[model samples]
Target: MTNNKTSEVPVQDPGADAVSESVIQLIRQHYTLDARRIRRIYAGLGSRNWVVYTPQETYFVKEFISSEDAQKGKRSIEVATHCITSGIASPSTVANRAGEHLTLLEDGGLALFSYVHSDEQIDKFSIDMMAAAGVNLADTHRALSRYTAPGEDETDEWLDMDVAEIVETVDEILGEISKLDQTSEFDEVSRRLLQDRKVQLANYSRLIEPIRILTRGVIHGDYGQKNLIVDDTQCLWVIDFGSADIFLPAYELGRAAFPPENFDHDDWLDRGLSMIKSYALRGALTRQNLVFCARAWLVQLLQSVYGVKQHYLKPHELQEDLDLFWLRRGKATATLFESLEEVEASIERIL
Candidate 1:
């Protein structure tokens, strides 16, 4: 946890040259790859990612962060492989030079992921898709039951949201704001949120309940649409365990609701419930725990409110930060919150 602001990611360089080259070589060694003809495809805007293209096969290449940041990425790949091996629609790791899913390149860390051929349309997030996601996620959790975090020496729980970390993130964001040279626009509410974070940090303890470890398993810490690759066949190919972890179900559920600002609110809520019900259908979710899952959304929203306030929306993105979270204002914390409340209430009614 460096003091670098929330604006400055711990792993700043996404595509290190050495890592990228190593990844290309590794893929060529292990898979059917056209080393000279490989071209980079733009799959995601955030990460320094490249899609390797060949006549017969296509795969993904990514330069990860430094050693410290690469651990999570490595854990995510391991977790996904476990799920695939256990029959989940998960992509397997192709070749990791460091034996761990990551290898240190001259510029930074690098890893290769199986590129899924996806043509699945972004349908209006429906109950069916949600439920499928949930059931699949439960299966993911079940599969991860045997896996553990890759690095043995690291003691910090990746799933646990530490107060110190929150404070650190806040401080880092503010520092970045100071560096931005344009403070007048963000001066008003952002300042208030920064000052109030001290209170939020204090109140974080009051919000704790007995953590529901519904099942002990590896979690795709960032389990949502952006991370999943759905093929034309409608098969869900889970990828990017960069934010993956070995932790409780509650942690995974909470993280699911905190998507970037541009994501659809209705889709977020509906899919959330679908995931819960799917887990329930698989006997992974119990009635009482479902109520807890609902509460988990609230807790997640609360934390996200803090995070959204701290982190700057993508410069190129259209929606304003507060507008995205307008629902979670005086009465609304996030646009997604009310729908979540309804979902939770629905669960309670059934109970």
Candidate 2:
């Protein structure tokens, strides 16, 4: 939710001319509006997003980068439709003149949707807002409970990671870290954290057994403040279903609770529990689920570290700042993990 500005800014890509021409062509051919202006929206890690403004109405367009991702985009729209019919606040898809939800691009796919105007000030979310978000999340889960994907069979694989898979991932990350030259500060810190994560995973290996049996369903893959939008009428609309997949419900809850922006908040724990309690009122959230929440927090921390490691391996111009950022995040995550026991106890009382 950073760097979100809605102005008449040009697209960042150097090939903006060609891209805009193609998009304009799509709009003119498929829709009934004179495209007035278009500006890129800097949100989400996946997909190139743009806000297309017309004299009649505005639209949000997404251009997928891969065929598999395009398929997911199609599935996401279907999921959103189900959620909408179930009374969840989500965006409505804007199909082309051909009556198709997706426009197949050469490399991937494209889709247009009704633009949702929202406040991007996630850091300013009030306690009531947090609680509301929790309730909506539960509502989303309940609505998705009855969702059966088209052509879905036993052979369809969902994007879920079990404890065993997480453990294997830990080993792989550690091995990758060890192979790096330990000269730079980033390398040194990454190696140290990776080693510690290996130990932590070993200690908490037993917790995985209970987590595997928790409530599983279609969850908003990246549910957090970033994906939420407060519409003109103050209704919160959840967007960006690109990562939607079948997974433990607790994963979504935990992701919402441990967003990096909330790390420094004084009453984050209280607010997080309040959201959890609100969610429980609409859906099932047991003490066992709270345990998995703690585990989820740890996993998020490890994932952050792994992300930093990946950045270190890649060639980027902001290498200096990236290392500093990783160090700071590493320290914060380590500090949180140290106090996780106390955090878990407090969350337990709420249950």
Candidate 3:
């Protein structure tokens, strides 16, 4: 479940005793900093890691769950760097130490990164911009498919596992979460998500299995505009490879199918068509494969349900996402799954 921890506004420059001091120190020392200022910006997926602001730059510092697991995460980032340099866009890694991606601070963990443009969500993203992202993402996947994981890759952790484990874990947290006096609605929402998840478990697994095995490569487990930056020149700079992996093509393609806004029905088929066209520019698009891709999109939607269930999202949030999710799906269903297929055909005919 999501950390319902009371919001503690982070100090502009918290001291060494703050949350991850040892790791931060190691990172600074690795950078050979004479000592200036280090500020904690936000907590990342891993509690031990953070988005840090140094005097002259920004970085992602990750403290290992333990030194034993250190190499696994470190190697993942190292491989991710290869993926980025190979053509995928990712936050550049400027340094590495102790087999990890960043300096190993005395406190714990490691650090790595180069400064990136600020993450301010655009009010409106042009179709051209999204098309560019689709193309970029496809090129990245194709490049990564050529390589295999390092000996210590952590990308395999979530593979071949049933959805039951995640559901059980989320269900176990519900009672404890409800004990907190936040609001009744959140608890209610959590409960319903749990129930919906119980029914959807088998369906999720079946849908995921085919694509998971078909498009196995270094997959970006997470892909969204939040981790992407479009500069003044419209060059898309992708960041945050913390969840890159070897997984399904459907996963990545489904993610690219949606535009930045809350999912909608109107023009989605056209949107999907454009997105796929961008991805398959020099490649062939088969009718059979695109149908599988449509199913993959549905699987991705259900995966969100799994996430909401596990994260204990508020009922209102779940409702909002569900509405958008179905809206997008509704369009695909209406088009008889030919939106993307038609786009491919149009391109083929043109060629």
lDDT of each: 0.54, 0.68, 0.53
For residue 128, give model 3's deviation from the true position in Å. 3.2
Q: Where's the lowest-lDDT run of ten residues in candidate 3?
A: 1-10
The TM-scores of all predictions, comma-separated, are 0.66, 0.80, 0.64
lDDT order, best first, reads 2, 1, 3
Q: Can you tell me which runs of candidate 2 are displaced by over 4 Å?
A: 5-16, 120-124, 150-192, 242-244, 303-306, 315-332
Per-residue alpha-carbon lDDT of candidate 1 for residues 1-351, written as tens digits (9 for 90 to 100):
011111211112455355445555656655444643334443332345666555666556665535654555655666667667778776665564335555655545556666777664555245666666666777776666556543231113432567686677667666666676667644545555555655645655554453444433456666776666667777776766544444456556544533443244535555565566667777755666666665554455455444354245334232343433432331333343435547668656544
lDDT of 2 at 148: 72
Better of 2 and 3 by TM-score: 2
Poorest lDDT segment (10 consecutive residues) of candidate 1: 1-10
Task: List residue ranges in candidate 1 displaced over 4 A.
Answer: 1-32, 37-47, 69-73, 96-109, 148-206, 210-217, 242-244, 257-263, 266-268, 304-343
Instruction: Please give the lDDT score at residue 127 for candidate 1.
Output: 60
State candidate 3's TM-score: 0.64
RMSD in order of candidates: 7.9, 4.4, 7.0
Cα lDDT of model 2 by residue, 70-108, tens digit: 887888888788889999888888877778988877777
| Candidate 3 per-residue lDDT over residues 100-185, each given as its tens digit | 35544333445566655542444224456566766877776676666655233433454555466656665665665667777565
